[model samples]
Target: MTSPSDAPEGTEPGTEPGTEPGTEPGTVRPGGRTARVRAAVLEAAGDMLAEQGFHGLDLAEVARRAEVGKTTVYRRWGTVAGLVADLLTDMAEQSLPRAETGSLEGDLLANARLVRRTLSDPRQGPLFRAVIAAATGDARTAEALHRFYEVRVAEWAPCVREAVERGELPAGTDAAEVVRAVSAPLYYRLLTTDAPLDEDAARRAAAAAVAAARAGAFVRTP
Candidate 1:
């Protein structure tokens, strides 16, 4: 559960030393007291969600755990939904960049592996499950979760686009759909079964996605 502030240099957007608009209120700038406090609060919020799910999240508890003023948390994030939205935003910003492997299969394999890693990670797995469960009944949380997936899908869509350009996939392939295809089954397995997400599962996911893309299953209809 590494916070965005703790991410290595150049790994995440807006990590450099400067102000960036649309960041969480207290995190307008990076590498300062404000940024540190923001990181602490978000970390505490994530921990609470991972441990007790979103229904258990409390702003006062988060502030106490973060050792920051309760007023600051309330003022900055207003509500639990707002805080969870910012947490999902931070997670999206902190995600790894897409792989640039030459072939479509290789690139898809890399993408599948990344998804597998995140869904299989101890901290991230529980955190995602909690967020997803919360989203089921919370409109704001659902919107935030959708946005998070949109960002991730956009980040990886270029791989499928490149495959199309290289004639590895059918022309007019829907890149986003192809990328989502690689993750759909993995997520289903994660939510439904108690099976372990092994490398074999990742490879199969990638292979299926590649087969679909090559067969024009992802082609966009006019």
Candidate 2:
């Protein structure tokens, strides 16, 4: 299993794949001081998730890491699971808009590339594994994990459905399933093996998914 890194830096959950936060205006806009505090808290939570695993996560510890008041952490996030759920929301909001690469192949590749980039990060990959392991034990964590992936898949599924509408793919294609296909192998690699989740693998997965979907893999056959 990939372990979370301590003080290891990678892309922020809310930022674009290649771009950092604060570089793009509409990418993320913290509304007020409280929102900023919440962001800091979530970052600290992410760090904790990667390094300590969820069972070891403490709101007070997160507050200390974020340099915020313990009361503030409790007030905002309520509990460790609550805090993690909110952090998942923050991560969803920060992910970049779906790529509009025109062709289904291009769009799928874009989606795969983005997933690979994020999950392959030095910090993020391990943190994800830790949280996933936590999810197996904690119902709340499992729900949060489900929501995180659901949001991500939804963000990218439109491209596939749009392709079908445009006649690039068969009608009645399962957009969400198509999107999942692109990342399924990457996750399998991340979970089952010690192989690096590399760019080539991401591209190949995307290509295969797009090709398979075009062949009606997601179509409802009579």
Candidate 3:
């Protein structure tokens, strides 16, 4: 797995830097230097992304910002799509651990709030929009975007499954889809409307999703 600092530079089809934060259970390594480098690269990439958009980025400039060699950037990530893929992977690996609130409603609420916060972030939202635009023209960029969401959904699926097991939700609920539902509106707000992504929105989304799950909206049809 790539570290935070190892994110490549570019705004091309595959050029998005990412960071993998947090620990991997049962895996240990002396990672101090590596972690610092990864963090530096990701931060620099984000700064560039927010300041200049995707088209404004170049690998050489990223190397300059990262204080690494252009060759190093090229060797690690060959294409723009490769860089974005690494960035997406780093994001997945480093994102906060999923919440386990012991109830589907609580967990979904937590997820909604977190998603709102992320999409509403001043730095991240524009960067995301830039990437989304880029993805429209690049298949690899689109794939990376899909994987990013997939990882997030998978991380929260257990909470939905647990609810089903506890009879708080009907059996046969597609846990990942249930998890995704809570964030759909949050992203909708981020992308479509200028509506504030406040606590109220988060709570409402979560409550609605939980209600839907209980009503068997998530059950897989035979």
Best by lDDT: 1
lDDT per residue, candidate 2, 31-51, as tens digits? 556567777888999998888
Of the pair 2 and 3, which is ahead by lDDT? Answer: 2
lDDT of prediction 2: 0.80
What lDDT, from 0 to 1, does candidate 1 have? 0.87
Badly placed stretches (over 4 Å) of model 1 are 1-31
- Candidate 1 C-alpha lDDT tens digits along 1-222: 235676446545333334343555433435676678779999999999988999999999999999997876775677899889889988999999999989999999999999999999988998999999999999988999999999999999998898888889889999999999999999999999999999999999999999988999988999
Could you give me the TM-score of model 2 versus the true structure? 0.83
Residue lDDT tens for model 3, 11-100: 123222332333231112224554455556566676777778777767678778999766646644556666665666677788888898
TM-scores, in order shown?
A: 0.87, 0.83, 0.81
Sorted on TM-score, best first, the list reads: 1, 2, 3
lDDT at 71, model 3:
61
Taking every candidate in turn, the Cα RMSD to the unseen true structure, in Å, is 7.5, 10.8, 8.2
